[model samples]
Target: MTALMKQNIRRITTVLVSSAMSAFATVQTVGNFSVLSMNTAGLPDFLQGNDVPGDKTENHRMIGAKFVEYGYDIINVQELEFKLNLGQDFNYHAALYSTASLPYRTPTSGGVPFGSGLNTLSRYSFTDTTRVKWNDCSNFGGADCLTPKGFTLVRVLLSSSPEGYAYVDVYNIHADAGVTNADLVARASNLRQLSEYIDNWSAGNAVIIAGDTNSRYTRVRDEIRILTRENGMTDPWVELIRDGVDPTEETICANPTTLSYCETVDKMFYRSSPVLNLQAIGWSYESSRFLQPNGDILSDHNPIVATFSWSLPASLRQSELYGGPHDTWFSDTGVLSRIFSPRISTIRFRGGSRLDAVSVAHVDGTSITHGGTGGRASELKLTDGETWTEAKLCLGQRNNRTGVFAIKARTSAGRTLTAGSSTEDCAEFVAPGGWGIVGFVGGSGSEIDKLGFLFAPH
Candidate 1:
């Protein structure tokens, strides 16, 4: 550690750090998108015209015009089925589909007695679309079994970041209608089936579930809680409009246009993933936008809309982030660390049997630290030309909560640093080809709750 050597190190660190910061500024991803969920009430022309004002064919044209005007990024509509025998030329489904402005859309799952009546329109491209019919249906009060009422799932390509293409699993569902005991039982089964489907198909992915649930938070028999309780989804109406409070009983909206007092069955839910972070920034009931010339309502149920802002790490590439969902998320990019050419200079850890804290210092002299300060402290310093090439983490119960229990870092020069207790549930992350681990991302609080690596070229 001579004076001239220290001066040279500082100069090199400054140049590398500055370059990393500049690169990060160009790759950061942040943007806002909007979604609309509506039940178009696209029943048979005779049945639909009797229930809602105006002709079914004309109403569909009006609804589609509004959808185009609103410019929603994603649109979920239920009861949009068409039956050829019921007058193909005058079908409401065809009228609505023809006027939609969104460039991308899901084709009708089926016709009348067979279709799920669920469709999704989006501004972005989507793939892997699938529709599942509910196993349970109620014939006591509503003819729910006459049609294949169920849900549709689509993986939408939201945007592209340095990490990869950001994708979200969007679900649109229409549950059994009515409030009879048999109907309640059927709706409960519908929600449970959807919960299981999400767990099985959309695991570890960001998701947005919305449509005519035909269930309410205040209704005890709705069982709408299963989506949140079982799958960790957030209801934007409850979170943003209701102030995170569930009304004890059905709330009568004095003015539905305000969107503050209404608890419509048409609802929306969302959940974020380790790769993408989603936050509901705005919500509206959309009462005025869908009105006719004389101010007639569009359908039996008003359209509900939600606006979300998303963000992801600005790294060249990232390993799968691991941990529980109970802490604040952080990324090395927030601290101006470069994810392309930076190298890890030092890694410090504090823990005994469970990792309590982690601190990483880069070649640029900028360091990012996370977690608490309760465990013993240890540090690993890499010499010139040495860099971390692999990381192993054990994720398990710590203080009854899921978190990082152990960590091991191995360098290109063969030096190793280890901490905490290794367990059966362990995951290893290795840099590919000429890449090396240079930074970190994940959730952390009093202890290191989550852990993931960011890679850069040597």
Candidate 2:
């Protein structure tokens, strides 16, 4: 059972090896609060099984100090010391009162915790609070039900928001752990119960649900789907996937080869629009920075955080993205013969001839002129919702002629970038100057889709 605990309980220790992290794309932090979720296996001193078995009260205290130093607005902590009679020895109470003194805090759930070991620290006072233990967890087959693995929900003022939506509902959850059929079923039940609670508690208000979900992103099927697709909550990480990139490439795992290093179980789910005037401007996972003063990760799971700005600008609004106007047409030599080497004269301006929309989208389309000649393109029109700071596109070519795709971006200042003679396609560029024209210059013929993208201005 001890070995099984170590094998299954990932919140006790981290596996981050010393390695420089690779750079990811910069995100625009418009008007969102910084929120975090981590499962701190502070109970059962040997949870991490690294050193002698003894109370790690000091380590837990220091972890709280780290959170204070991070200056985030909200944090959801899981798996703290649950021994009720420990009094002063209780690390959770000490950690909270010690380093987190300045920020407003949530009152610790009273009564013997039954081991929920869950708590939320925030920068604002709670307007409403609700806590409940899972009705589905059990300890007979595994040690899951020993602790009260449940969830907490509260509402706080997003004082930083300019959109007048200061009240935001927040749900902090810790689900059952394991891979057996029983474990999976238990987790599924917990999720359903949580979702139902969300539905019953509020009328689809502005909400952010986060914590150690204990679900794997790589799993073919799991409870996360219920929380996301079915529940209508947006996964910020998924929303931030760069245009034209595979969704799987975006990960909380640092080493994919072994699945041994940094992996993700922590998540943040949110909503924006009619009820919640929040927009997710940025999202990232704590990798290199996932450490304590002693240079080791404070917890086994990497922290995932997202930035939301309620006072978002026109460009950062959610509706600005017009994903699939998918107007497609191509010219082949046989019937729909369209000439090759289309000059700026032939470039198709989305939403009309002037390219006057907030942003334009393009894609290398189905070839028509010949089997591999004329490159086809898609047209796009940008409207409302999330504005961006940059424009990007992907370009492909044929082996017959020199594959050259010409792109022209013209600014209000008349400054222009010309991609007249370049083999380089499939790339990103600053978009202070909105695009004017996109067409093929050389290359026997090339198809282009995802011709343009908009990156929100930070």
Best by TM-score: 1
* Residues 1-458 of candidate 1: C-alpha lDDT, one tens digit per residue: 99999999999999998778657634555678999998987887554453577777788899998889878899999988656574345456778988987899998766667777889999998866788989999988777998889999987878743343466889999999899999999999999999998876665568999899989887888999999899999999889877998778777653226556667788899998755689999988887788778877768777889999987643345566677655766666434333336777898888887888888898777777888897888899999988888889998885678999889989998888888888899988877546677767667888888777766667
Error of 1 at 193 (Å): 0.7
lDDT of 2: 0.51
> On residues 374-404, what C-alpha lDDT tens digit does candidate 2 reach at each position?
3233332322322223333324333432121
- What TM-score fits each model? 0.66, 0.55
Using lDDT as the measure, the top candidate is: 1
Local distance difference test, each candidate: 0.80, 0.51
Can you tell me which runs of candidate 1 are displaced by over 4 Å?
1-28, 48-50, 86-90, 253-259, 313-458
**Model 2 lDDT-worst window of ten:** 17-26
